[model samples]
Target: MIARKFWVLALGILMIGFSSSVTAEVPEIGQKAPDFRLSTPDGHPVRLSEFTAKGTVVLVVLRGFPGYQCPYCQKQVHDFLLNGDKFAAAGAEVLLVYPGPPADLDQHAKEFLAKQNPLPANVHLVVDPDYAFTNQYGLRWDAPHETAYPSTFLIDGQGAVFFRKVSREHGDRTTAADVLGELERDKAAHAH
Candidate 1:
């Protein structure tokens, strides 16, 4: 009976350790954005640090192919693309994350991009197979018919997030105009 109790205590401690290691906290404003590496749709490696030279980095986390291609995700991409010129004018780079299961994630991202070919120079489409980026940012939805909570953050050249929005629902999202306005404000704040 003593041996049995010892084994149970050991297992309990192990479970607690494992669970704590798996959890991550979402970054807040004025905190350095967590760094992660992912590949662009074309199979080229891209890192969050790579965009630091481009001024503000507008990070968009999509729901990915949760159960099917999300229409709201498509519309959000279009909204940003439609304002590509404005983003460029503000010297900002947009990184769109398409996250889902590891199988065929690249192909899924490619097909999604086909809807709006010729992405803007300032914009990049990256795939997060196996939810590495999503998990790191603590945005995983982990429910039936959902993959991740759509989110957006504005990271400055120094990699500090100045603005953040994570939507629990699909419809509400930050628009291009909203990000653009924040970029202008960020610029003004940095100038001083």
Candidate 2:
């Protein structure tokens, strides 16, 4: 029940991330997930390589537009924060990449946090700093009224992408249930 809402928030963020900018398609699944280290509003830094090596990593790429104040984006942050338990139960690490100009990164992060409760310890809100990570993954959006489209990628413990969804508009894409379902399916498969 509670899990559904959090995932919707995440999916909304992904939808916005995917629909925001026009970027060439990024590295596809079964490939090594690109890595980066970015400043987080939480005053800590999130390094991708460091995380990917640890556990299953769920990367939620967000379009950082502190100027527009996307209500959808706001909800996404809240959703994830609310469902921290479900994510941890699945042994997943979630990283929210705040992508945009470096100047706007901090402001947007602060606004995101302000609009929602504190991020669960398991979730890391990292800055993309000029869209470094976004470009590497080929998930950048180069359109107007949008900065970067919403996208979600699930990387396994070995750093290989297993699942990914890039939203083309403001709605539809990965959801919390979808993610948990994937994790459970993969875990069951591994058990065999």
Candidate 3:
């Protein structure tokens, strides 16, 4: 009986360690944001480092074609579109990441864009093929009818994360105003 108990304890500990190692943590504030290279629907490669090299980057991960277009994602994109000028005026590049299965992902992203106004020049919509970028950023939803957890991160010119928000559900996503506020705060902080 003592040997059996010892085996059970060992198994439990092993399981705990394995699970912890498998889960990826979101990059914390001040941590270097993970650099990624994803493509726009038109096949242009958008590299995170290139954007960070110039100015602040607002990275937004969206649910893409989880069997159907996500209304919440649409709303969030619309909100950002409304404030496009503000984001550009702040010298920030807004990168919208649409993650889904690789199959026909580009068509779905195009359809999603069809429903919205022409994206501002400073705002670019990039596709995350097969959830590669999502998984790298630890935002994959990994469930039925889900592509990725809605997430937003503010990375400065040096690639340091200044703000982050990951929403488990459909709503509760970070807004343009929220990111703009963070940019102002970061700028002021660095001015000193």
As a whole number from 0 to 100, the lDDT of residue 116 in candidate 2 is: 61
Q: What are the models' TM-scores?
A: 0.90, 0.81, 0.87
lDDT of 2 by residue, 53-86 (tens): 7799888877767356667665676677677799
Flag regions of model 2 displaced more than 4 Å: 1-25
Question: Order the candidates by TM-score, highest first — what do you get?
Answer: 1, 3, 2
Cα RMSD of predicted structure 1: 3.1
lDDT of 1 by residue, 1-22 (tens): 9999999999999999999688
* Predicted candidate 3 versus true structure: per-residue lDDT over 57-82, tens digit per residue: 99998987798999999999999999
Superposing all C-alpha atoms, what RMSD in Å does each candidate have to the true structure? Answer: 3.1, 15.1, 5.3
Error of 1 at 75 (Å): 0.5
Off by over 4 Å in 1: 1-22
